[model samples]
Target: MDMRAPEQKYDPYRNYTRQQWSKLRDDMPMALNADEIAALRSMHDRLDLREVEEIYLPLSRLLSMYVGAHQRLYIAQRKFLHIEDRKMPYIIGVAGSVAVGKSTTARVLQALLARWSPKPKVDLVTTDGFLFPNAVLERNGIMQKKGFPESYDLPLLLQFLSDIKAGRTNVRAPVYSHLTYDIVPDRFVEIDQPDILIVEGVNVLQAGRLPRDGKAVPVVSDFFDFSVYIDADEPVLREWYVKRFLALRDTAFHDPRSYFNRYALLSDEEATATALAIWERTNLANLEDNILPTRPRATLILKKGADHVIENVALRRL
Candidate 1:
């Protein structure tokens, strides 16, 4: 099946078919092996060696070049100002709909970037850690809107990025647990000065809302040097979401401590129905309202096919 996006006149992005994108890899060596791929692949996500070689390798090569260029620019600007060139992290935002394989994309990029020459320390952080605690959500009566933009601590997230971008060392971010489906109290992840920081989330690219006085608020994407959006047909994403929900029933959902333990006893049919309802009511609405609208803001977009293969890549022209 042809999975290419329909051609549009006056489009800003320069599109490439998968085969064309694979050619850009040229002499770049593959940094990942079969075992590593298996470890990086998220539950219910398909990411084989062939997909990595054809899609991620070229993408990683491109990112490495961007990082190098940014570093040189930093030095040049510092020299012009006659100041010390204090190195700052190159922040990359990975944004996409739920079940769109964005988490796997972030992990793969982190692994690949860490292996590159000069071996800059690369760190990965998700915006999940910035979500409001369960108690706050419940108090606000927005627990049902958990993934919505309002469910996050926007000011805190903005401050975290600001501190990192200001070259602050030893920044700490809250830790979140998917098993318990809530923020872990008193637990934090320390991010030392890293060469690259990958911030992945469903709302990373979302623009902040205007205030009552019409003053502009800073957005998380404003701090991102480069951003990526993972794209797939809606039906494909829904199918993956349902499959992942079912898979978790046998895995994480079976744990008595899991927030979703109630789903563990559901029959396959019942689970599918429940998953579809949740997706339609929550995830799909979030995608349409908050995520998909940010596609044009990305530096690059990875368009996946029904089989979870990236079939096209759209890179914004400089």
Candidate 2:
């Protein structure tokens, strides 16, 4: 296979303006019912189903086409290389800064892809499952850098993807707990081969830090058929982070097992200050050093406005 960069021009900050994307809103296909949409909308401080339709529907369709292309490539490779009886899963990687809406993008894409009658069993997985337990991070004195690429079990993650790409079935991924902010020991989700597999996280597009000699395989993104990077201005993302933290303090953080339980008792002023502090010291630092550098590595870039809506879509022209 000739491995070269796609011929498409890369535009880092292009997006669909609200008005343009809104035109597709009314007729968008929805995998979730109204009640589920409403519930997810309530969970997000400033997002709703309409946004999903306008911004994400087109994205879903785009991914579906890529998925089809990937399958065709697999068939061609098997015929030409004489490697019969091999079926690699079509993998998509979604990367972005923290609180930049990559999670919502992954989930929405998962649901939309499943709505395709031809491939209605799409599976969604996140790199969160590869993150080491909180206790391990604390012991390694990197708890504050939890979202950094080194925070994950890279070897294990790579092996998992390797299995899937090798046409292995019944693979399992660790389960992560948002409330606890850690990997749940002994818990895992089994993934069956599907037409598509979506993996979303802060650093999915990053190259591996270790050499391939006994310590590391290739980066997980190398296995992806398509990749996306969700982007927004640094300041806007910081504000969103703080806002999300405040909102979570009122909800998820209040739960007894939440790793952020300490935030539940913070006064509004204190909570805001803490959120800003964490963003500055940790999240923002990781975004600049790790995540931002990987944006150009994506096949598509979804840029956002201050209002937290995608404003333009930049597709790498093939």
Candidate 3:
């Protein structure tokens, strides 16, 4: 068996190794301290100050530049059209497979961007809130496909984004609880005219499956000023997912309020078996069928190594 990794192919993106990408920071002082990085790190996520300095700091800086450019363009366009500057928030979409650390990326960017010059208000919203309610999923018989594209309230999500793009303030989004594993009834998150909004989810970049009639519909990525896709080897992602499941079982799953409380008393072997089964049956299938296919649509791709460290960055060429 010739067990070598497949040969790399030429791509539209300009690839930069980690070392090369880090240099782009160029004496820019690190915006975040160790404590902040620690706070931003999600459960079972392997993030540290070094990774922040090398990877996220540069990314934050790049995003800041993009935001600035976008603002200037917005102003120019408004002036050309003889209209007032409504100042829509810059939208950034972060997408990746389960347990790929995209939540950490979104949190880090939100924190770092808020600290930058002009210090724009930043908001982070996950598409989990846009998921169809449990009752709806049950009725549709897709309870097992919770993270798949069809499981989301796509129209509502699109409307929210449209309002944000139109500079509407106090837009309300539904709230979802991970502990309950469902959307909380009558609970909402209000986004009040943030300067930047980061939308994170497994399917943020996914395009809707086209119908036979060739009618066009706006997808989530259509609202993004910039998009990032976290990339990793499938085996590494599977390992991380399993590890996260185990960690949650020891912590959140023990709470009586948790939907997964039933798994809290499972033996380690049983827990591992359960986690593996869930991942293989749902998450892996979602990744292969939906998430991975949208990778090319991102403006930036942060490619992670087996160690959960971002080893390279591929930036889409202008």
Pairs of colliding residues, candidate 3: none
Q: Model 3: what TM-score? A: 0.95
lDDT of 1: 0.93
lDDT of 3 by residue, 10-68 (tens): 46899999999998886657777888889999988889988988988888878878998
lDDT of 2 by residue, 181-210 (tens): 889989999988766788989999997566
Cα deviation of 269, candidate 3, in Å: 1.0
lDDT of each: 0.93, 0.82, 0.92
Candidate 1 lDDT, 22-116, residue by residue in tens: 99987789888999999999988889999989988898899888988998999999999999846889999999999999999999999888989
Candidates 2 and 3 compared by TM-score, better number: 3
List where candidate 1 sits over 4 angstroms from the true fold.
1-8, 210-216
lDDT of 3 at 299: 97
Higher-lDDT candidate among 2 and 3? 3
